[model samples]
Every structure is written in C-alpha cells, then in structure tokens.
Target: MRLSMDLELQDIPGQLLLALQPLKDNKANIISVVHHRERKTPRGTIPVRFVVEMDRSKLDAVKSQLVSLGVTVVRAGEVRFIEDVAVVLVGHILDSDLGDTINRIDSTGYAEVMDLALTMPGVNEPSSAYLRIRATGKAEIHKALSILRQVGEEKKLLVIEPIEDEAA
Candidate 1:
C-alpha cells in the first residue's frame, strides 16, 4: 500500500532523523521524502512529506509510532490533496507578520501552503509574494483563502485572488 504523510517536526538538529525513525522501526519502506527547511507550518514548525510503502495492516502501527515520538501528523489518509490554488499577496509581507498569516491557514488542518515566492524591490518598497496552496477539497480551499483574505485585510496587504484556468 502507498501512504502519504504530512508531519511537523521541530527545527533542531537530528529532529528529521528522529521523525524518520518511526517509519524504520515499523518496517515501512520510504519511497520519497520532500522536506522543506525554508518553509514552515503556521506554528513555526517544519513540514515534512513522506511517501512510504508498507503492508496495509501495518499502517496503523506506523502512525501510532509516529505519534508516540511527538511528531504532529498533519494529514494521513487515502484521499490525496488533488486540488491546487494560487494567490498573490502584494504588500510588506515581511513586516506584516508572514508567519502568523501562514499559521492561520495551516491551523485549519485541511489545507497546506505548499510553495511561496517573494519579490522585494527594496527595503522601502512594498514586497509581493505568490503562494501556492493545496487542499483536499474545494470547501477547504475556500476556507483557507477566506482566512488569508482576512489576514491580508487586517495587515493592509493587497490580496489578488487566483483566476482558475478554464482550459484545465
């Protein structure tokens, strides 16, 4: 069986290795891992992605082991996040508390901010960023976007909603 897990690990030495130890202890074979050290979850935690192959019956045990190790499992299910949404934020992202904004969306537990790109003109000029968010369902995506919009409005940032590609 193929399983995908989203985990939050502490930003410290050997934390990633500690998080992976559960899978090894449970005999789950890892297929791929996408670890982002630059980007963090809403709680200033590192998000780690893992694709593992193991016996179907051992899935629960692997999850249990991960939990025991104090790793926060953000998502663990058969239904993958097949939908993507992109939004652009134009303003002083760095000064507006970007970490808090990201945390609000991630705290929903239904959506994840996958990628972010920032463009800074200068110290005095306003900055802009493109955020790619992924959610399991349309409702969850809307919820995340709404939260982001609220945060932007509160911070006086310009939020440009994504235009869906009709051709896709």
Candidate 2:
C-alpha cells in the first residue's frame, strides 16, 4: 500500500536522518520526499512530507517506530493529488516531438502529465493526443496550459484547453 506521511522534525543537523530511520527499518520504499526545511510549524519545527510504499501489515509498525524516534507524524494516509486538467492536442502529434511537449509541462514543477491517450492513424497523417495534467493549484493549471500552448505553437500542433464555453 502507498502512504503519504506528513512529519514535523527539528530544524537541526541529523533531524531528517533520525526521522527516516523508522521508514528504513520498516522496509518502506521511499517514492518522493518534499522536505520543507524553510517552513516551520507552530512550535518552530520543520515540516517534511513523504510518499512511501509499504506492505499493509507493516504500516502500523512504521508509524509506531517513527513516533518513538521523536518524529511527529502529522498525517499519514493514501497519497493522492487533487487537481487535474484535461487537454487535447491535434495535428502532427508524433512528428512534432510529443515527448518534449509533455516534458515541457512536467518540468514546470507545479504540474505533471498524469495520464495520456494518443490516436495515430498512419505515419503520414496528423495525430491527436489527450493528456490529463495534475497541478498543484488553479493558477498553476493556467501556467501549465500556457506552457503547452507555447510548445504547441513551436511544434505546429494545436492545443485545446478545457472550458465550458465553446465559442470563447
């Protein structure tokens, strides 16, 4: 099972290592760690967030071990991202460097291509691609779309952003 854990650690040397030791001991595979060293809690402790995968049976042990090590587990549960925007790219998706197009949006740090569907009839024909981008916020979604538009223009592809109005 995948778990998202939010921890509070002291803002001092070896604090991070001390918090991670329980995860190591419990055999949880670390996926991503967003260490917010500059952000402090009400008590002036650093906030750290992690996405980890571990056996369901071992989760309880890990949580216990972490608490024993003086690490405050603020929250722990299944990891999930809330924001998603669907976009369509029409025209020469394959010929126009699709990988680069996707990478451009992902490199922004606030958005990522979470899902994609491609349709290509032939090598000499234009193709269409549908992508679902997960972003951190509403503003970031617009920024990601702007990046997509810029990339699409550079590659001669058409970008269709999702909206309620058809004529806008």
Candidate 3:
C-alpha cells in the first residue's frame, strides 16, 4: 500500500534519520520526503512529510518505532494523489518524443502519467495517445494540463482535455 505520512521532529540533527529508519526497517520503500527544516511548528519542531510504499499491516510497527524514537506521526494512512485527469493526444506522438512528454508531468513532482495507450497505424502516420494523469489536487491537475498544453503546442499535437477541466 502507498501512504503519505506527516511527522514532527525536533530541531536537532539526526531527527530525519529517526523518521526514515523506522520506514526502512519495516521494509517500506521511501518515495518522497518533504522536510521543511526552515519552517518550524508551534511546538518549535520541524514538519516532515513522507510518501512511501509499504505493507499496510506493518503500519502500527512503523508508528510505534517512530514514537519510540521521539518522532510524532501526525498522519500516515493516505494514498499519494487524490485527483486524476484523462487526456488525449492526436498527432505524431512517437516522432514528437513521448518520453519527454511524460517526463514533463512526472518531473513536476505534483503530477504523473499513471496510464498511457498509444496507437501507431503506420510509420509515417499520425498516432493517437490516451493518458491518465494523477495529481495531488485540482490546482495541481490544472498545472499539469497547462504543461501538457504547452507541450502539445510545441509538438504540434492536438490536446483533448476534459470539458470539466476546461473551465479556466
């Protein structure tokens, strides 16, 4: 299962190590860690957010480990992203560099291509691609679509966005 865990740590060194070691020992694959060291909580602690892929059953053990290590686990049972958008590209997708297109979304760190289907009828023919993009929220979905629009314009492809998402 995928989880997004929020933790509070002291302003001392090695606090991040404390937050990470439990996930590591519990065999959790750390996906992303957002450590706002410059920002302090009301309790004068640092707020750290972690996204990991781990077994659901081992959640309690990880939490217990963190608590024992003096780390506060604020929230820990959320999936990575909450919003998704589907888009269609109609043009010479392969020749226009598909990998870079996907990377544009993934590199944003706020959105990613969760699914893709491409159809190429002939070597010189235009192809059609269907992509499912997942983002953290509605604003992020718009941000991703903006990037996609720019990419489509640069590649001279037709970008079909959902009508519900076109209310900008």
Q: Which candidate is the best by lDDT?
A: 3
TM-score leaderboard ranking: 2, 3, 1
lDDT string, candidate 2, 25-126, tens digits = 888888657777656788989888776778868877878888898888888877555578999999998777778888987666556899999999988888
Model 1, runs deviating above 4 Å: 1-79, 164-168
Judged by lDDT against the true structure, how good is candidate 1? 0.80
TM-score versus the correct structure, for each prediction: 0.53, 0.62, 0.60
Residue pairs clashing in model 3 are none
lDDT of 3 by residue, 49-129 (tens): 777889999999999999998999888886668899999999989888999999999877657999999999998888999
As for lDDT, the candidate ahead, 2 or 3, is 3
Q: Per-candidate RMSD vs. true structure?
A: 13.2, 6.2, 5.5
Indicate the worst ten consecutive residues by lDDT in candidate 2. 135-144
Residue by residue across 1-168, what tens digits does model 1's lDDT show? 666787889887888898888789778777556676667877888988776777767777777887898888888655367778999999999998898888887655557789999999999899999999887555567767888999998999999988755642
Off-target runs (Cα >4 Å) in candidate 3 are: 80-93, 97-100, 103-110, 114-134, 137-168
| Global lDDT scores for all candidate models | 0.80, 0.81, 0.87
Pairs that collide in candidate 1 are 42-103
Q: What is the total number of backbone clashes in candidate 3?
A: 0
